[model samples]
Target: MSDIATVVDLLTDALGADAVDVDPASLASASHDTWPVSTKWARQDEHPYPADVVARARTEQDVVAVLRVADETGIPVTPRALGSSVTGQPLPTRGGIVLDVSGLVGPHSIDEIDMTVTAPAGTNGGELEDALNAAGWTMRFSPQSLYRSSVGGWLATLATGQFSSRYGGVEDLVVGYRVVLADGEIAELTASPRAAMGPDLRRLFLGSEGTLGVITQVTYKILPLPADQRLQAFRVPDVPAGLAIMREQAAAGLRPFLLRFYDTDEARHAMADPGFDGPVLFVGTEGEPAVAAAEMGVLTEIAARHGATTLGPEPAAAWMGRRFDFSTVEKRLDTPGGFAETIEVAHTWRHIHGLYTDVKAALAPLADEVLVHFSHVYPQGTSMYLILLGQVADDAAATARLEEIWATAMRVCLDHGAELSHHHGGGLARSPYSRRSLGSAHRVLRRLKHALDPDALLNPGKLGL
Candidate 1:
């Protein structure tokens, strides 16, 4: 039998025949992710890099069984959850086995005493959040894909949510992980109350992109649902002034669950404010009633000091109602000869302005229009999202244009001394630049990959591995 067949037989014996699928339809579906280039390829009736088999793992033991067979047979195995990653993080580049872990869900356990919630990696993020909400608790992580993404994807990609300014990213929320290594050995990296135990080993898998191991379970810190909440929008003179207001608020140790600043173009398009004439800032706070009020008051003062005009709560409220609506990009992607992409980069306050200007300028020629915003902020820096929409004449042009857009944006970010990606981990889209972006640290990553997955079979071709 061929290598693919041999691995398929082994996996079938280990996890049962029902768990393995070799149907052409399943294989085709497993080949690509939500990568924009893949959409173009699909339009041309192409299914490149189709996996030979898809193995659905219903439990941790099933994951171990799949990895064990792949390890013994040297078959490339890509772990996948909801496949919501737009950067092709879960694509089986080498056409081996697509290990489906979406079934390893729930039987979630929440420890109200410790303020943490543990769930199988495949648990849907929105479901988990809803459960927490019903219990008067929350993880405070709400990515745009909350309804579609899995917990594993969140940790795998180091994803951040709209509320990241206050609650922080997935890396900050995760307290532990249950992972299955490439060699089929299970490792539990959980410690409570912040231990100093040797470099925080759980981080090894937080953004590993499933190269080092498969995350089967996760434990995230939780918070009681806030008793009070407030949201307000302000019209700022320009991007710089808006950013200054955000920086000052963060520097003053105020944590707002919602903190976003949109450039004039993006504000006019994204917000419901029809009369938007300048850059806009959205601020939201949640906590005890008095505390939330105090924070909102400070934000208003800061905005006034920066020459911002209050637009009341309507704009902010409207945003909150549809914060997860991604139809703008989705609609474009659904149309023929059209595409939309969002690139996010970050830098300290000093370089952010220049970085934003340089990247936006470089990308303007590539896309029909470039809409910019600063959605996540920190005391020292903030993350900028560049949303661009464009149309091409054909599939070939769409493919080429997508590549050019990514290349131009990444080049400008690196040139301007900015992080290549703020929260979107290095997937296939960023793999080409991962080495240069990581620099000396790339060597360290290679060593770790070799040490854990010497054959380079786990999610091969990602993270420049």
Candidate 2:
């Protein structure tokens, strides 16, 4: 029998027949992510990295069993949820087993006293937010993929939401989580608001992209829903002026719930009204009425200092109404030989503009249209997102162009001293550059990978592990 057939037989014997799926359709579906290159390759009817079999895990015990079986049989295991990852995080690169954990949902609880919520990792992000909102509370984690992303996926990728400027990323909100190690050992890491515990074990798993272990459950910080919310829009002279405003606001300790700066190209594409010509800045503040009003006042004053033209709240409100609409991307990709992708990178205030300019210049020649935006701002730095769209002669040409775009963009980011990724984890798309991007720190990551998963049986070929 073939190796994959033998592994499937072993898995079926260990788990139930219902848990093991070897259908060709299932394997093909389990293979790729939303990665543009992967999608383009799919257009050619090819699944280069197909999973051998899919194990539908319904509980933490099932996850343990799957991991144990994989370890015993030397099969690489890739944990998956919702399949919404655009970075190829869930792709089974080595054609082993795809551990589908979406079935392990429910049995969640909220602690109003402690202001926290706990749920299985497979729990849907949007459902959790709805539950919190019903109780007049909020997780404040609203990524574009919230409706499709799972808690475990968020933890695995260290995701950041639209309101991350105030609530911070998944790393900041995740108080604790339970993980199943490669050897099938289940471990829970928990802590209070602040801990003197050595090393912050949670950090090791956050953004690990399933290289170390499988996240089974997560506990996140929660807050009372904001009593007041405000929105405003402004048009700055150029990208640099918008960056200056964001830097000043962050440095001044203004914690706006949302701060979006779209370059001229992105503004033209994103704004409902395309009359305004310059870069557009959207500012949102939410909290107690008095506090929100005061914060809006300061934000407006800062915009005025940057020579911004007030465009009222209509544009910002419009953006909020359709923030999750990815129809444009879908429509673009549906066109023959058409492709689109987004690359996000981060740099300190001192080098952000240079990084932005260099990357934009480098990608402009490769793509038909290149749009830029700055979001997830921090006191010391911010992330820049570049959206590239183009059309080629066929799938092969599209795939090659997609690769060139990624290579060029990553090269520009590294040369300019910026991180290759901000919120999106380094999945297969960025794995090749992970070592170079992390520099000397890559050695430490390798050591951790060796210590945790010496056999490299978990989510291989990701995060340079």
Candidate 3:
């Protein structure tokens, strides 16, 4: 029998008829990720509905059953949590099955003594944080996707948040996890304040891109809500001057709750061209009111030396309003012939200016127009987020343009010696350049995939697995 027929039979018997989405229509939406560029691939990339089945997985046993079918049929499968991914990470490539775990959400549970929360991967970060904050606690991490993005996807992509300069990231805050491996084995990261025991097994799947495993649950350390908070804004003459202001703040060790920089193009679009006219810097400070005031002075002082103009409280509130929900740009992409997207890359303090210069140099020629914005500050460095706007006549030309821009952007990041991805996974679009950043380690990663899932039955097209 063909793999499709064989796998369908197994899924029906294993999961019962209720869990499968046999309709060709329902499965189509599950097959593609959110890339305007992928509209180009829509014709050739018609992913076959796996053995013609989509599994609604809930319990651990259900996941294991799905994996058994994956290994038996040599078809691929990818797990889904909260369904908030922009990059097609949750979409099943080669169509073995989309093991949807959104139904397995756990009840909000918090431990006041230990200051930790244990919950299923299906849980939403914003929802969990709301509950915690009501009880006089807080989750410092706030990725731009916070409103809709889940804790699991954020951790899977090594996501950084708006307050990354203070709270660190999902990896540093998470102390434990329940991960289901590709071969159906379940591994739990032991709960501990800290461990000297071997390498952190928790980190193994932290940013593994759903290729290594599917995370089922997470337990994280929590911090107390601050007594005071403040957000401030500054405008710089140009890119170099804006970056210099950031470096000066970092050098002085004034780590604000939020430290973000936006280029002129991004600033103009965001501020409705007020004509005050310059790149913008935003810093959020929170803690004791006295301490918040001190940090604000430090930030304002640094900007003055660099010729940056000050915008008072009103602009800061405006920036905070649209800090997340970047997916609005996708609305433009949805306009039949319109296309828009963003790319984020990271590097250390020394290479920051050079990386920014090269990335624009590479992508500008390919795109009709390119805009860069900075958010999610950290002691190590910043994340450069790129936005592209293009209008294409047909699928063929759109594909060519996307390919060119993605390639040029990847080259610029690598040539300047920055990590290919700061938060987002390589997805199918980013996988080709994985070799550039990962090198020989990429080969070993493939080997690990073979050992754990020799059938290549898990998220097949992503990260080149």
**Steric clashes per prediction:** 0, 0, 2
User: Is 1 or 2 the stronger prediction by lDDT?
Assistant: 2
lDDT tens digits, residues 371-456, model 3?
88776566667778888888777556666777777888887787788887777777767877787688888898888778766766
lDDT of 1 by residue, 318-437 (tens): 888898888888788778879888888889999999988888888889999899999999889999998999999876787889989999998888888789888877888999989989
Error of 2 at 253 (Å): 0.5
Per-residue lDDT of candidate 2, residues 69-92 (tens digit): 888888899999898888888999
TM for candidate 1 is 0.98
Better of 1 and 3 by lDDT: 1
Q: Candidate 1 — what's its lDDT? A: 0.89
Candidate 1, superposed: residue stretches over 4 Å from native = 273-275
Q: Which lDDT values do the candidates have, in the order given?
A: 0.89, 0.90, 0.75
Angstrom error at residue 312, model 3: 0.8
With candidate 2 superimposed using the best TM-score fit, by how many Å does residue 382's alpha carbon deviate from the native? 0.6
